[model samples]
Structure formats: structure tokens, C-alpha cells
Target: MIRQPFKARTPEELISLLSAVAMAILAAIIVMVLYYGREIIIPIALAVLLSFVLAPLVRLVQRLRIPRSLAVVSVVVIAFAFIFAMGSLLATQLAQLAGDLPRYQSTISEKIQSFRETTAGRGTLERASSMLKDLSKELDKPKEAANSLGTIAAPKAASPKPVPVEVLQPDPGALESLQTLISPLLHPLATTGIIVIFVIFILLQREDLRNRLIRLAGSDDLQRTTAALDDAASRLSRLFLIQLLLNGSFGIIIGMGLWLIGVPSAILWGILAAVLRFVPYIGAVIAAAFPLALAVAVDPTWTMLLWTIALFVVVEPVVGHVLEPMVYGHSTGLSPVAVVASATFWTALWGPIGLVLATPLTVCLVVLGRHVERLEFLDVMFGDRPALSPPEIFYQRMLAGDPTEASAKAEEFLKERSLGSYYDEVALRGLQLAQADAERGALAPDRLTKIRDAVQEFANNISEQDERPSPKVNPTTDVEATSAIEGVAEDAPYESLRVLRKEDLPSEWQGDHPVLCLAGRNPIDEAAAIMLAQLTDAHGLSSRVEAAGALSTANIFRLETAGVAIACLVYMDASSPAHMRYSVRRLRRKLPKATIILGCWMKDIDPAALESLREGAKADLAAATLGGALKLCIEATGVDSLGTGAEGQISKITAAS
Candidate 1:
């Protein structure tokens, strides 16, 4: 038998695992209780949601010089009266629809006959009947006497005398039968009553309830609790108010459309559409199904059905895409997936009521999760807020070796910000991610290669596609240095090796004094170096990039003779600056006249460690970001390289008459 090694978990890891298990158990218990106690919980949830919707109305009524109780009573009565009146109208329409249903029997029969004719022919039905008759005859063959071929018939046993048995049953009276019939109705009616009373109380004492909840959950942080409660109330109230207006408008449009199309009981279908649409995702389709079916039943020519469908198709898209988004604007704070999942979850827990309440309930959960420290994971998992910022997204895509998407994201960002900002925020962070992975040895050699290749592609392609032309360094001015830089990679794009000519130099900048950007030992370092070069070029500063380790004695002499003024060494993941100190010191020794600035680019930095690194490297300055490094380089060189023309051109051509 072979014995395997057992790895023990750290204390923190163990505690985290146990905490996750406890949370899972607690969640399961909550779900179970919610499902079983829905009879009580559902009404409370409904009351809370309705109160959120109606609280504004109650407040408005209270502002008319009426007592609070009177305002509540008046608002509730008016609301219920409107609902009851609508219900009566619907009942009357339903009765009329029922009476008219028989008139459509001829139409339905005609449709059936048409379908039969289309499927085969009128003779097909008669043929089918004849076939069935023949089948019946064949199945009803008389049974012959048992053949003696393979069986010997046993003699019949003597018949026994029959025994009598008596069974007793109780008859249900009319009252018991009536009670059985109305039991289901009684539960629903009682729940409605409870919801009404709860809504009234909730509106009357909303402030007291809110204070109690804050004290219970956030006594230590009352400000945060109050803010969270206010946010939740405002969001839910706005959602309901906007939703009511949109749905009411939708119903009106539906009614008008149906009435124009001569659909019977158009108002009934309109009300149903408005009500059913409160449920998300599939509600519109379900609401459409009823009217569509009724249209078919009422009309033999299919015109009404077609028109009904067209009306829904047009209105739904217009409202959903245009008006709904314009009004809601991320108000619910539930993601699309979260909305669907919550709908399914709540529907399972409390049936249709749960489905109707899903979005509001989820909005509440998201708000709580956002404000409560312990429940923050819920917001992280379910909220509509972006899970990743643009930079993180770009970095992740690059790590996954998807340059196309990463480039697309970069391009989208470029529409709003400068190219240098994009490089600093997105490209630099991406390189840092690669550096971290490489340092941890989590990235395989081939994967690292792919990531490097992808990032390079993104950088090169995105630069070319920029609407503004990027500054280019003229190779004629310094052929040797340009060749030395360009020869580093035979297939490298121009984005990695552009040099500004004398004509493009800023007024205060000398053509000979360009910045020399050096890459460290890794590809990430080279990527950062390229980013710095791009940024420097954008500011009308001539710059050239080369790998520090790739530089030869001859190349160094050529660069020295090239009259470069600043040598910027970029290191993306130099934890201690041990590897880069030698490069900076060497560059300082070779280019004694030039300023040496070490670019220690990272997302986070320790000031002490950075100071020590700068001191050890014998460099003039150390910066944590590309922007800072560029600033240092500018200050050291004493040049403000902002350009006045397109593509790092500091002077614009004046049109002479």
C-alpha cells in the first residue's frame, strides 16, 4: 500500500472553510423557513412592497391639512376603491366575454376544418374513420374455445357458496361540503386582510419601524444604517412609481391597439397585460398568449390575431428598450442573471406572489448587502454593479491571452480619455499582473509567452488604429541607435520603436537630448518601457526603448554618442531593486551626462523600500507609476513637452493668404 502525504490547512484557511459551511447551512435554513412559512411571510413581504409603492401617496394626502390617520385612511380607501372598480369592470367584461364565447364556436370549427383541409384533404377524415372502423372489427374477433394443441384443460373446481360483506360510509352534509369548497378562498381572503392592515400600519409608523431596524442591525454605525435604509426606500419607491406609470401607459396603448383592431373586451386584455407584466422575463409573453388566443377564437380570418401580435411586438420593444431603460437606469441594482434567478427562486418559495415580489425583494437584499459588512458577499455576487473595473478587465483578458477583447476594451476607453492615460491605467496594470504571476511561478512558460504576445499585439494594433497619429522618431537622425533599438526584435511593430525627429521636438527640447527607456529582465518590463515611450512621444519628447539586458558594449557606446539626455529604466516587478540597481548604475556610468531615473512601476509600493531602492540604484528618482516616472523625467530634463499640433507636433502650420 502506498501512503500519500497529507497537507494541513492554515488556521485562517480552516476558519474560512468553516465559516463558508456555516453560511451555506444558514442560507438553506432560511430558504426552507421562507418556503414553509410563506403563508405568513408572503403577506408581510407584500405589505412592505405595497407600502413602498403607496407611501408617497399617503404623504401627499397628509400634506393637505389632514390628520395622518385620516390621510392613511383616505389614500388606502381611494386606492382600494380604484382597484375594486377595475375588478368590477373586469368581471362585467368577463361575463360579456363568456356570452360571446359561443358565437366564436363557428369560427373555431371553421379553423379546425381549414386545418384539416390544409393537413391532408376533406376525404382524409373519412378515410381515417373507415380505417378505425376496420381496426375495431379486427380487434373484436370472437374468442374461440381453448385449443387443446399444447395445453390440457384442467377440470373446473366445484363452485363455493358466496360470502356477504358490509361496508359503512358517512355522508357529508351541505355545510361540510360548503366549508370544504370555501376553505381555499378563506385563506386567500384572510391573507389579503392581513396585507391591508399591515400596509396601513407600515405607512403610519414607517419612521419608527426604520429606527427599530437600524438599532437592531447597526447600532454601532447608525449613520451607515440610516443611509442604507434611506437608499433602499428611495430606490424601491422610485422603481414602483416608474413601473406603475410605464405599465399603465402600456396598458392604455394595448387597449387602444386592441380596440382599433376590434378585439372584444380590449380593456380586460389591457388590464391583464398591465398586471401580468409586473412579473419579469416571461410575463409579457404569458400576457400576450391570452389575448392572442382570444383573437384567434373571435376571428376566422386571422387578421385580429396578426394585428394583436404586431401591437405587442412594436410596443414591447419600444417600451423595454427605450422608455424602461431611460426611467429605471440601474435603479433595481439586480443584474439580469440575478433577476431571472431571483424570479425562479422566489416563485419556487411562494408561487406567483413570490415571482411578482422577486425584483423588490432582491433590491432590498442587494441594498442590505452593500451596506452591511457581514452580508457584502451578497452584493458582490448578485448586484448589477460591475464586478471588475476597466483596468482589471483588461488585465484579466490579457492573462487569458485574448488580445482582441483586450484591445477592444482599450479602444472603448480611448474614446473617453487620452492614450497615455489608457496606457497608465490599463496597459501598465496588465503588465503588472503578468509580472506578479511570473514571480509566483503560476504562469507557465508558454502561457507567459502567449500573454506577452497578446499584450504586444494589443499595444501595436491599438496604437495604429488611434484616430490621432502617434509621434514617430526619425531614424535618419540617429541610425545607429535606432537600429540598435529596432534590431532587438525583427518583427516588432513601429509602436515599440518610434523616435521623434528634430522638426517634431518641442521648442525647449533639443533634438539630441531624447529619453532612453530601458526594459528590465522580463517581457513585462519591456511592455512597461514601451508604454513609457508611447507616453513620452505623446508629450513631444523623443524617446527610444531597448531591453537593458539586451544592450551590448557597442550599443551602449552608440547610445552614449547619440546624445540621449535621460535614461529611464522601467522595472515592473523588482521587489527589492537588486536586479535593476546594476542596470541603473551601469547606465549612469555609461551616460554620466544624462539623468538616471529608475521607473519602479507597480500597483502598490512601500515608500521606505522605494527610497532604499532609489538610494541603492544611485538614481535621481524612483516612481511607482508611468505617469510619475514621466513627470520625474520631465522635471529632471527641464522640459514641458506638451505639443500644439497633431502627433506630438509642437507648432501648428499657419495658413497664409
Candidate 2:
């Protein structure tokens, strides 16, 4: 066997390979900087977040006729003072907690014994222990038997016993002792100092920093850069502020709950929880561990521990699910997976501090991606919004031959839109994409067949839905006044044909199948015709669908045209007007007196081209959407047949035309 050497078939392939390699290299470099330079970056990140939290306060103080420098100083001083007070209180509580642990030793021992007694019976643990004992006895029997049988070895000369030795240095003087005591604190003090300095400068020179960022990002697109910055700042500020308040509230509630439950050092646990909750996902669990362990040690019975567990289980969910969503609205805009992945990545690089800052940092990246075209992949990966639009998703699902998911998507869309609009906006557009791909020869025959089958199945699944189009008031129209009317407002956009009832259809259209929907030449054309027939049936006009082959010169005369009042030739790809004209002529010959309407379901079709096609086909009317076709059919029935209620609507449709 021989392997062929790799070669680029086109410049595009080579460029793509090079671009991917460059991106990988860039990512590796970024990771290295994040890991090695975290000490510097961490402080800056903290300072930036702190600045966001305090910006509103600084502005508020400045608004009260104070100097900007004074306002900033005042806000920063006040904020740090509160944080310092909390820190001192936490330290005191922690010291007390440590001092009290020895008192609970007896209770802890009793609980452990009780737990062991309860689980000592024939379970997995007990069986494993018994087996280990038997194995140990079996091994020892060999040594004992050898000794009993007097299987002795020759004695060797006695070895000398080694003496123990110890080495000690002189005791340190006071200066050395003081240096030793303070050495461990130096790093933390230095880090704190850096953070404070950064925060002060960031707040004082906020505008300067923003301008520098904009310049670094790009001065050419100032508007976009400014918008991105504003979006990021506002989002981060709102997130930080709300998180602070919610976490603080959570702590206060936990403290009160623990106090009521008689847990030791409740206040300490509460403050610890509030601080740790800033870290994502597992923070609450870590915070709960301290109090739960204390509960176990402090109480003889399991009541305290159970109560503490219950407190966390109940409170965390309520705050996380109910309160947080209500307060944050759309949240930090990072996807759940992005949040977890970022937490792991940043923690690996910078430890606990990175974990706490992960969400805020990822938000910045997502915002940047949203604004910068080159970095848009970041937003698509990390942002909470769906990456693909409805039409693209539908097309993808169709190609994958998953009609179930495609139908699900359609059902969701139909919740807010009428079936006609959904077909026009999503299904038809998806088929258009498939048609385009097929025309370009990019799709394999099998893939095209799968798409066609999936689309047919999806259309069939949703055909039973009620077709009375949902009345949608135009944005410019007064919704209140429109709602006050008995039926759909005349000024509202006509989504589909409206009939008072099935009985209200004209005598000519009263038969079991009054509308004939004929597919055009394309493979997907039958799917479009099916959609039109479904919509037509929904509006009280009974409809039947026929495949493109039914319109052939040989098969045309055999199509059932009896009692058919309207005939619509449906085309997914309407690029060739001559083919559409030929199909229209065949349908006209079959149903000579029937109203012939050309249904060209092309998105954004040029008006002149459509009119020319209609004229060339000699179609009574042409529609560029499923909704328009249904409307044209309804109009052909005449306003008198639909009763007085539909007169105004038909008149408006005519005036618009």
C-alpha cells in the first residue's frame, strides 16, 4: 500500500490551512501569557472590576456639586472602608470559630460512633472488611507453620545499634523573630497595595483609559468601538452590582437561618458564603461545608446538620432560579457551557482569583466578538444567543433528515406567527437555500433527496394545525383600536386569506377539493405546493396537491380538475420563467375556467421580473409568497361571496395592489 503526498487543490484550501495554523499559534501564545503573567493581569482585572462597581457612586457624588477627584476619593474610600470592616469582622469570627471547635469534640465522636454502628451490618463495606481479615490470617499462617516445624536458618553476627542524633541552631533574636512573623504576610500586602493603586488610577483616569482602549482597538471605527465599550461596561457594572446585592442578601439570610438552627459561628459562615459565592457553580457548596461540618460537631442529634443542609438546598435554588433571573433579566450573556469552561480554564491559569473573574472576563470577550468582525467566532461560541437563525437551522435539520426537529422548530415559530407567515418566512426560505445548493451542484443527489423527504414529512406533520391566520396588527397601527374591533383590522397586514367559515366559500369553491396546487419542475416544488394547499384548506377553501409529473403533457389531461375553482402552480426555484409559463399553460388547459395564479416562492424577487414572468405565463395573477397566493385565490372568489365583513379587507388589498 502507498500513501499519496498531500497537495492543495485550490488557493482557498491552502489559505484556510494557514489561517487555522495561525489561529492555533495565537491561542497558544494567549494561554502562555494568561498563565505566566497572571500575577500582573489578575490585579489589573480586579481593579477594572472594582472600578466598574464604584463608577455609579463616583458619578452620583459628582452630581451633588462635588469635584470629580473628591467624588472619586469619597466613593473609593467609603467602599474600601466597608470591605475592610467586613474583613476584620470575618477574621474575628474565624478566630472565635477555631477556639470553639475543641468544645464539640465529644459530640463529634458520639455521632461518628453512632454512624459506624448503623452501617456495621452485612453491607459492601462490612463484607470487604471481613474478606481483608481472612486474607491477612491466611498469609500469616505460612510464617507460623515454618516456626512450628523448626525450619531454622543459620544465625549471623550481631549488628551494631545506630544512635539517634539531633541538630539545633541558636535561638533567633527579636528582629529576626519579627521578620519571620511578617514574612508570610508580605506577598498578600503587596498584592493588596497593587490592586488598590490600580483601582484608584482606573477610577481617576477612567476616560483616559477608555480612549486608550478605543485607540488600541481601532480609531477608524470609533462608533463601533465606543458602542462595544459602552455595552461591556454597562453589562459588567450591572452584573457586579446585582451580584453583590444578591450575595449579600444570601449571606444575611443564611446567617439568620443558621442562628435559628443553633449552628456555631453562623455569622462567620454567612460572610464566608457571601465572599465565596463570587466564584461560579461550586462556591455555594464550599460555603455550605463549613457550617454543615460545624453542625455535625456541635449537635448530638442529626437535626442541626439536616437543618443546615435544608437551608442551603432551599435558599440557593430560590436565589439562583427565581431572584437572580428576575433581577438580571438576560444575565451576563455568557452561555452556561462557556461559563463552566471559562471557570476551569481561568482557574488552571490563575487559581481562585481567575475562577472569580472568569464570567466578567468572558463577557468582555463576547462583547468584543460581537463588535469586531474578525473576532465574531468568540460571540458565536460563548454568547447565549442561538448561533444559527431559524431558516439556517431548518435547512440544516432538513439536510440531516431530521423531520422531528424541523417540525419542532416550526411549531415554536408558529406560536408567535401564523402558519402562513412561518411557511413563507422559514420553510420556504429553507427550501430556497436547498434549491440554490442543488442548482450550484454543491449538494449530492442523495442529500437533495433526503432534504426533500424531510421537508415533505415536516409539512405533513404540521398540516393539521388551524389555518385561520393569527391577526397581526401592523406596527404603525394603533394596537388598542385594532383589538377593539370585532375581527382582524383592515389596516393590519393580511397574513393569509380569511373566510368567515367553510360555508362562506363561494358555490364554485364549495366542493370537497376546490383548489388545485400543481408543483413546478424542481424536486422541492411539491413541498411548496403542499404548504400552499395546507394554507388554502385552513382558510375554508378545500385544496388538493399534485406533483410536477402530473403537469406533463401526457399526464396533464388525466389530472382531476372537476369542481376546481382556483389553480396555483407552485415553484421553489422560479429563475426560469419559460418553464413556469409552460407549466401554467398546461394547468390552464386542464382547468380552462379556473383562476390560474402563479405561486413563485422566491425570497426578495425583483418586482419587474415577477411581473414579466406573470405576463409571459399569461397568469391571471402572480404571488411571490405563499401568503400572497392564498390572498389572490381568496380575492378571485370576489368580495360578494365572502360577505360584507370581508369587503373592507379585500378593498384594502386591492388599494395596496
Candidate 3:
């Protein structure tokens, strides 16, 4: 037997595949360009980040009637001046610290000597030393014999230096000496000059540059381009400003803490800390290293080193975890993994400079993903937003046969939503999925059983998990709630639905006012029926769920005698009204006086088909959601109040009447 080659049958599928391949190639090309062009790119990126930081200052200066160019120049000059001064101060402190290193040499020597003495006996060091000494003595015996033998062997004529040879050396010129001094500074000076020039020009022409970028990225769609650029600018500017303030605060705290701990050059350490922290992840460690090393060198004991370590360990976490979340919220829109991965990737591409620019660059990518259809994958992969909605997640859990997680997800949703809403949004949607799978012949028998059992268990425990009272609905002229149930099953289902046993009517569900919830063909539909019954019971209407088998021709007489005031026929996965119309008509005929409700439980229903269903089935009521159907059931029973103690009141009214 030969196997036929697989092929994409649809044009859309083929196009999608090609697009994915193209995106992969594009991403590779981008990584390569960023790596190779880093020399120029790094400075430009630095300048861009700096512009975000200094734009507000430039605006402030301009507000004072200063020309834009002059404002840009003034801010740049002041910033560079402060930076150079700080560098010079740090150099001076470093030189002094270096000079003081000699004083700690004695302390270091004493500690080394103590360690040696402490490990001298009965240890790996002692054994290693003993072995080395023995080996040396054995080697020295042969060397001594060789020396003795050489001395006995001889006399020879002395060699003499026959002639003097001239060797000329050229002296260094003044220019050459100057060149040597300046060559080390040349590249750095040139780069700094370029950065300053870029910063000044960017600040002066900020709006023009923004407009140019919009044209370059989205010339055909000006509105989208403008929105994307504005969003990116707003987010980047806010992130940079907040980070600067937070880092500055961190540095100030370190300085004060060090001062209280009696460490030298606390101010210098603080300044270094603030600047270095622009680099994420490892920045805090790098900033702490200098202060820790200085503490070790300046103090005669280890107390200062320990205290300095403790300070950073405490401060970094507090700022990173608590302060950042409280202030930034979801403004950055980056996942923690995305943050670290971007840092590593940028660091690899542009070295330390890339690390410094990673967050801003990643933010730009997220914004692009938000606006560009093709690049939406980046947002799904890296942005902090949830990839799957609650209904999708619940349905996926059910498909995977993880009842525990499905129930847990239901409970989580219940925290913010009502149990009825949960039924409509999560439980019913999951059943729709199962029904779809059963239709496609994709769901396994056992897996279907698991999904059914899980959903039923969740419905059964709604009251136990949520202690809140059920919502009140009026008995007459049932008001339709406007809460939209928004989920559709886009994927095929994987399993069959669970079957539910017909629940016995409660004692109070007697006389002429009991509610009957009719389960459809599948067990998943029965789960929905269970929820409706639960709601009816909560609404002061006594209710019971009955399987379809219990209401067949043979049992129609039994149901008629049961004194059920309302019959709610639940169809969670209604493919069409044609198949259900006969069953509904039969139920309607069997209970002529009872109010019949045909509930097509889904996110959406066709209005024409729904009207047809109502006409064909002769259902007195029709609903598209569990909540709607349950509301109709409660209304049909003529229960006015859903108060917690209404059962007792209802019993007393019945007795009085």
C-alpha cells in the first residue's frame, strides 16, 4: 500500500501557512540586522530612551519662553554636565578607595593565616601538602647528586665579550604622546557626541519625527498609524519616567541606609545605583557589588559587608514586587517571561546597551502587535493579557478531561459572577462543545463521560461554593435581563455528555405548583436542566429534574398526575428546531394546562428559527440562555419573592389559602 501526499485543500489554509513561514523569515532577518548594525543602532536606541526621559524637561523650559532649540540645548548641556561631574566625583572616590586598599592588606593577610592554621591538621589541605612535600624531597635528592657530580667534572676556559654593538632608539614626540593619551578616549567621546546631538535634534523635532514614523509605518492607514505611535509613545514615556523615579528612590534608600551603617562614599554608591539600574535583572546586583566590596575593604570586620548585602536583598524585592505593581499596573503590558527573554535577547545582540533598551524595545513590539494584524502573535505570546477567554478555558479543560481544573475555573468565575451566569457562560458552552464533538464523531466515549460527569458535578455544587442568595425576578410580566452571554463553540467537541438521574420531587413540590425541568437527549443537556432546577428551587418554586425517559408515552400519565405547574424543556445543543418540535409538541399535548418553555441554550440563536420553534412546538415560552429559561420557569410558578426564608412563607400562604 502506498501513502498519498498531504496537501492544503483550501486557498485560505495555504495562504495562512505561507504567511507563517514569511513571518518566521522576517523575524530571523530582523534579529540578524539588529546584531550586525548594533554599533550605530545602540546609540540611536540610547538617544531615543533618553529623549523620553528629557522631553518633559524640554517642554518645561519651552513654557518659560525659551526657543525649542535653546531649550533642547540647555537640557542637554545641563544633563551632560551633571553626568560628567558625577563621573569625575566617582573617579575621585574610586582613587581614594584604591589608596585605602593597602590598609586592608594586613587584615586580609591575618584572615588567610588564620584559615591556613585552622585547616592544617587532618584535612584534605593537610594531606595534599604532605604529599607535595614528600614528592619534593624525593626530587631534590636526585638534583643534589647531579649538582655534586657536575662540580667534580670540570674546568673550562672563560668566554669573553669580543666587541660592543650599537643599537639606536628613537625618542617619542609631543604629538605622539598626546595621541596616546587621547586615543583611549576617542571612541567614547565620539559616541557621546553623537548621542547628545541625536537627543537635541529629537527633542527639537519631536512632533515632526512622530509624523514621519507614522507615514513610514502606516501611510495608507493614517488613523491606525497615528493611534499606534501615540500609544507606544505614551506607554514608553510613562514607563521610563516611572522607572527613573523608582530607581532614584532605590538609590536614595541605599544611600541613606549605608550612611546609617557608617559606610564611606554613600553618595557615590547611590548615584551609581540609580544609573546602573536602567539595565534590568542583573542591574541591582551590579550596583550592590561596589558598595559591598568597599564595605569589605573599609571595615576591619565582616559586619559592614553583611549589612550592605541585607540592604540590597530587602530593597530590590520591595521595589520590584510591591512598588512596581502598585504604580505601573498593566501599563507596560509585558509578561515576566517576556521581560527576562527580551533582556537576554537584547543583551546578546547589543551587549550591555541592549540590556538597557530591552524593556522599551519590547514595549514597541507589543504595541505593533496590537495594531498590525500579521504581528498579532507577539501580543498573544508576550503581552500580559489572557490569551483565552474564560469560556474557552473552561471548555478546553472539559475536553482535556480535567474535571478538577474545570470546576476550579467555574469557582473562580463565580467569585465575580452569579451561578446562573456561570451556567450560561461556562457550563452550557462546555456542553455545546461536547455536542459538537459528538456530531463530528471526534469525541471518545470515555472522554465524553468524563466531561458530562464533571459538568454535572460543578452544577450540583453551585450552591455550596457560592453562598450568595439567588437574584430576585418578578413573577408576572417576566422582565428579560440584558446581560449578554457571549461565547460560541468554534472547535469540534471531544466527548459524550453525562446522563443525569431524575431527581425525586421535594416534599414542598406538591399540590398544584411544582416545576418540572425536562432534560434533552444528551447528559450535557441534563446538566443544564439541573442548573435550572437549582435556580427554580432558590426562587421559592419547588422543582425537580426529569429525564426524557421519565416523560415518554408510558409515563405521560404519571407526569400529568404529578401536578407540575411548569415544564421547562432544555436543549443545550440544539442543531435545529425540526428534530425537537415533535418531542416538544408531545410534551405540550401531555401537559395541556402546564406552561411549556423551550430553552435553546446557546450564546446566540437565529430569530427566525426561534419563532419557528415556538410556533411548531407550541411552547408558551422560548429562551436562548439558561438564565432566561430559568427566569421563565420561576415566573410560571407565580412565586413573587425569592427571599431566603420564602419557603416557610410560601408554606404558610398555601395553608391559609
Best by TM-score: 2
Give the worst 10-residue stretch by lDDT in candidate 3.
491-500
Better of 1 and 2 by lDDT: 2
Q: Give lDDT per model, in order.
A: 0.73, 0.78, 0.71
Tell me how far the alpha carbon of residue 219 in candidate 3 is from the true structure, in angstroms, after superposition. 8.7
What does the lDDT come to for candidate 1?
0.73
Give per-residue lDDT, candidate 2, residue 363: 81
Task: Assess every candidate by TM-score.
Answer: 0.78, 0.88, 0.79
Indicate the worst ten consecutive residues by lDDT in candidate 1: 481-490
Which 10-residue window of candidate 2 scores lowest in summed lDDT? 648-657
lDDT of 3 by residue, 1-657 (tens): 999898746998889999899989988998888889877777788898889888888888989999988889999999889878978888887887677778878877776677788888867988998999999999899999998888789765588968988999788799999999999999988888889989988888889999886665645878877877777776777778888899889989998999888788788888888877876677889999988877866777889999999999999999888998899863477888898899899889988777777887887788778766657888998898888877677777767766677666666666555566666666677677777777798877667666666666655555555344323322232223322221222110000001111232334345444788887766666767877787666545667887655556677567643677778888866676665777677777777777778877754676566656677766777777765665555444433322223331211100000
Arranged by lDDT, best first: 2, 1, 3
Candidate 1 C-alpha lDDT tens digits along 287-399: 89988998999888989999999999999888878999888763467788998999999988888878778877887788878877767887988898888877778778877
Error of 3 at 240 (Å): 0.8
Residue 413 CA displacement from its true place in model 3, Å: 3.3
